[model samples]
Structure formats: C-alpha cells, structure tokens
Target: MTSTAPAAGAATSGATSTGTSTATSSSLSTTINPTFRAPTPRHSSFTLSTISLCGQPEDVLDLQRGSYALWRDRVEMKLAIYQVLDHVISDVANPADPEWLSLDFIIKGWIYDLITPELRTAVSSPGATARTIWVAIETLFRNNGLARAMMLSDEFRNTKQLENPLSVYIGKLKAISDEHRDLGYPLETHALLLQLVCGLHERHETIGKYIQTEAATLDLLRLRGGQALHG
Candidate 1:
C-alpha cells in the first residue's frame, strides 16, 4: 500500500498527457488543411495575343494595283469578327491602359504588314493610333474626284477576259465599278451587266449571250452564281 498513491497519480498523469496530445493534433490538422486550400486552383488568363485570326487577308493594299474597297472590306470584317474593330475604327479604351496599348501595337503592326512598304511609311507616324493610321491609308486610296472616276471608268470598259479566268475578270470589273461609285459616279446595273458580258472571251460566248438575253431578269447575284458554275 506504500506506493498505491504514486501509481494512481502516474496513471492520471498519463491519461492527461494523451488527451493533450490528441487535442494538439486535432488543432494542427484543422490549421494545416485550411491553410492548404487546394492550392487555390490557379486559373489562366485570356489576352489579345492568344487570339487566333484564322489567317491574314487575301489581298494586300497596293495603291496602284490593289482594290482598296475589297481590302478594306475584308480587313474590317475580320477585325469585327474578332471583336477588335474598335482598335482601328474608334478609341475604345483609355490611352494610358497597358492592355489597350499592347493590343493597339499589335493591330498597328498587322496593318503595316498588309500594306506595301511605301504605303506603310506614308501612313504611319510617331506614336500614331491605329485609327489614325487607318484613316491615313483610307485617305490615300479613297480620295474621290472626277479624274479618278474617269480613269476607272476607262479601265472598266477596257477590261477583257482573254486568258484570265472568268472569276478573276469579274472581280476586276467589280473592283473598278466600286471605285467609280465611290467617286459619286455609280454605273447603272444594266450597263454594268452589259460591260460584264462585253468583256467575256469567245469561249464564254454562250453564257454571255444568255446573260444578255436575260439581262432584265438576271441580277448580279444570279450572274455570279452562273459564273461559279462555269468558272
């Protein structure tokens, strides 16, 4: 009986130590699990550089040979599709915004790539916005006058299918007509159809006669469909 109290005290001390260890372990587990937080599950970001435009435009801007109207239409449509048309058409963001500046730089470089080396220098200036470059290029190519209209009209009438494919020949005529119209001298649809037929090669005589015969009923759309079939 001499050591009974000591043994009981020892057992009580052991039980208390076990309980404290269990409590401490539980506290540490709660703290560590919460702190881990599954590593916050990082998410990637989207930016203009990540965007894909599918491909560059088919037509490059050449004042002497390229159709400005066609090139503009294609380029603008592409920008609109990618939701970046405002970069070239309007100021959609703050000038000081870093993100907008990056996008603008990218678009400016793209515009420069699409034009001839000479036109690039003529349109671009120090710290110029995309809209400024766009307007400058447009002014260079689309300045309308009686002299330009007459020159395009002559080119339109003189176009011949010859060895060129019908599609290409029609494209030339349409481009000339578009430029002439931009000069406030729109040709009549019937007259355009006649010129389209007149420029056809002898091999296309049958279709040309058909177009001439049905001139009143056939529209440009139908004429283009016929061209695709026979092109």
Candidate 2:
C-alpha cells in the first residue's frame, strides 16, 4: 500500500488514502491536494496514553546530514520508543478521518529539539504528515547493501550474551537479525540457532540439550532458557 513519503516537488504532498480516509488539510495550502491522503496503517507507540517523553528532546532522530550508522542508531532508538508506545511503523494515521493530532505531536516534539530551522522547514510545515517525515528520515539515513549487511551479521555473531539480562540480550540479537532480514541477507535458521546457543551460559544449555520434542526452533530454545532462568 502507498505511504506518505516526502514530497518530490514544492507542491503540497499528495496523500495515499486508505478506504475513504483522507489527510487533515494543511494550513499552508489553501488549495487541497485531492491526490494526498493518509498513509497505510502505521504500526507505532507505548501504552498509547502513558507514553511520556522521559528522554531529552535531543534524543530524537535528526534530519541533518550525518553518518549512516549514527543516524540509523538514533532512528532505531526513536522507533523503539514508538514500539513501546504501541506504534508499529505501519501507519500513524487514524483509520477514520486522518487526525493530525498524532502527526502534530510527533512534529512538535521533533521541531525545535532535534532538527535545525532549515531541516524543520520540511517537517514542521502544516503540510507534513507523520509518515512523510518518517519516510524522509529513512530516505536520508537508510544505508543498505551487501557490505553493510555483512557487517551487521558480523556484529550479530560477535554479540555474545555476556552477563546481561537474557531478555535484553535476546532483544538486541533479534533486532540485528531483523536488520539482516530487511537487507535480504537473513541468517539461516541453523546459523541463527548456533549464534543463539553461543550466547547461553552452560546452565541454560542443558534445557535445549535435553529437549526431545520433535525439533525445536531456536526461539523456543531461548524461551525454554528464559523459563529455566526465571524458575
């Protein structure tokens, strides 16, 4: 489904409507761009209501030109916040008439905090949709290729599960694995299993070593280990 990417030209961005849903009319443009509409379902947020900004405004993602990894790291952190708040990057637009409330809140939080006035010219405008800004940021920073994926995979391989919380370690591992998947170089199931098993302490290894139920996926082994740890 079409999403609200950054505008190609100077005109108000055309919307990609879902059903009859439409974008909130922009204050900057008196003439409505009928082509513009809300984005596809944005999977985003925390407990929705309880998502207070605990971190500083500077912690938000930036549009300024920067290193790809650094920019992506910030974006990941921001997306992690959105995920916690129950926003899944699907589409932030409401299924009904697209309320700019969510988009406005995002832009307002981002406007003065992370972006320069020059950068803000694009996103803080009354015309910018959340998804538009979101995609724009990705376009600005999404560096992907064979070399990057290989580097990410190597990082994944080196990321041993030290003494850190199992859940946290697993989350990081899964996140890296997901990046690999998105980049079209996903780890094979067996390769992922080996990486996972490599992280477990000797104690947790026993759970998987003894499990005889058909063939357990690596995820299940991790789950079993978690249960054993908490037990």
Each prediction's RMSD over C-alphas, in Å, is 10.8, 20.0
User: Candidate 1 — what's its lDDT?
Assistant: 0.75
Model 2: residues with Cα > 4 Å off, grouped in runs: 1-133, 145-147, 208-215, 218-231
Give the range where candidate 2 is weakest over 10 consecutive residues by summed lDDT. Answer: 10-19
Cα lDDT tens digits for candidate 1, 1-231: 376988899999999999999999997998888555644321121455564443544556776665677788888997776567888888565679766777777777778878888899888899898888999998876563566677777788899989998778877777777776765788888988999898899999988888888788766655665653455
Write candidate 2's Cα lDDT for 1-231 as tens digits.
765454442233333442224433443243566676675565332234344443564454443322334444565476564542223244655534444355445544542355555555544446555555556555534443466676777788798777876676667677677766655676776666566677766666674354333135336345535763344
Residue 39 local lDDT, model 1: 45
- With candidate 2 superimposed using the best TM-score fit, by how many Å does residue 74's alpha carbon deviate from the native? 12
**What TM-score does prediction 1 earn?**
0.65
Candidate 1, 190: how far from true, in Å? Answer: 2.9
Candidate 2, 109: how far from true, in Å? 5.9
Where model 1 places Cα greater than 4 Å from the true spot, the runs are: 1-57, 144-148, 165-168, 227-231
Candidates' C-alpha lDDT: 0.75, 0.53
**Please, what is the TM-score per model?**
0.65, 0.42
